[model samples]
Target: MVMENEEVSFADTVFGFWEDSQVHSVNSSNSSNDEEENYDDEEETFCTKEKNKAFWEEQGQLLQATLCRTSSIETKVRHATKEALGELNASERRCICGQLEVAKAKSCCRNCLDRDIRDRLLSLGFNCYISKSKWNNSPGTPSGEHTYLEVIDTSNSKRGEVKVVIELSFRAEFEMARANEEYNQLIMKLPEVFVGKGERLRVLVKILCSAAKKCMKEKNIHLAPWRKQKYMLAKWLGTYDRSTMETLPRAYTNRPQKPKTSMLTYDLLEKIPGLHCTTAVEVV
Candidate 1:
């Protein structure tokens, strides 16, 4: 009887110890799991904080850059505006095109509107390269002979500068149609040329008309025509759809759809704290 009791007690004690050990093991496992979860949460928080810090820093840099750019643009505009006003005040005689002819002439023709426009651009710190044969090498030359102007930055050297190909029309209707044709041809050819040369091409059309009743007829008739032309150009050149279009079409296409990514990118860029658009053209 004593031996049986001792055996029973030993079995009960062993079973209780085993149960206690299992409970302790479970508690230990739970505590370890909690610590791991806490560590993961801390790690995620650290990563998020670092990302936020980097994003703000990048935004600050972009803001500074944007402000500097705006200041420079404003200065240029002031200078250009002063020069244009001075030219207008100095010129009294009207050319054949009914536009004022400035005094300085590169050639003998005083009645030439193109020359007057060229001179005006020159006064605005652009180098008129229209007369040069070398600069006249445009892909769409024979059918569309456009004037090319180099925007000279006096602050920087002449090695790298903004190159502009311009088509000036004294008449709005004729010019708009012609500009569209010319833009289409150039857009088709420029990509290949850009890829080969690793340079970007910028083209502009300047329409010059008198403020007289016969030419303008209304307060802002020119705005609609100009806006349409620019919109068509943007569409044809693939600038409007490049970022958001799903199916990859040709670079220069008549069909343009708003890109999904482009609006987001534009919004992000606009929200860069101090960024502002200061150029005559929004894209530029």
Candidate 2:
């Protein structure tokens, strides 16, 4: 009996010890798993933060580059505008086409106008070239009243582009022609005016040529023959779709729409007898 009891007690004690050890092992495993889980969570959070930071950095760089480019372009445009204004200030006024303003009479003339226009165009960094022969006066036409100017397009040399001659002729065409002739003669007399590289005579010549052509075109008018009369009636006309160009390489067609005709219709000085007018007698 004693031995059986002792054996039973020993077995119970061993079983109890085994159960305690298993419980401890389970607790240790759970603690280890929790630690690993916390570590993983921390690592994931760090990675997400790093990715977000890198993305924002890249975006910032892109934004900075965009702003820099915009600023540079704006600066260039501002500089160009200022330079053009400066040239304008230096230019002397002359009666190229407009009525001779008495205020500018002594300061302005054909020579001054030509130089001012050329200088303004050149300051903008354009390559100017003039043709060998200048534009001629076309009498008895819309263009008859304007001075002509032609300029070469150095920007698009591949297209062999030439600026349309501008004509300025609101005032008197004859007066403009005489002034131009005098100016040309004066320029020809000055070797430094057109033959020197330092003076940029080539560029000036081109600018002048182009200006002359444009002025001519602007002053050009279409004239129609009067009934049985040798003289023709004049009317202003245009070839461009718009007053100012919005885009380059203008679309041109040989068959263009004609401008609307303008004429005064005289219908007996009165529309239908004015319902019996009151008569006043003049005493002789």
RMSD of each: 28.1, 26.3
**How would you encode candidate 2's per-residue C-alpha lDDT over 31-147 as one tens digit per residue?**
999999999999999997687456445444443343233233234433443454355445433344444532242344543344444444445654322222222234532232222
Which candidate gets the maximum lDDT versus the true structure?
2
Per-residue accuracy of model 1 over 1-284 as CA lDDT, tens digit each: 45644555777889999999999999999999999999999999999768745644544444334323323533553355345435544554333333433233222232253344455656556554333212122232221112222233444565465333232221222233323332233223211101000022112211111112112332333433323333323322221111111221211122344766766356754568777766686664
What range of 10 consecutive residues in model 2 has the weakest lDDT sum?
227-236
In candidate 1, what residue range of length 10 has the lowest lDDT sum? 189-198
Candidate 1 off by > 4 Å: 1-7, 62-284
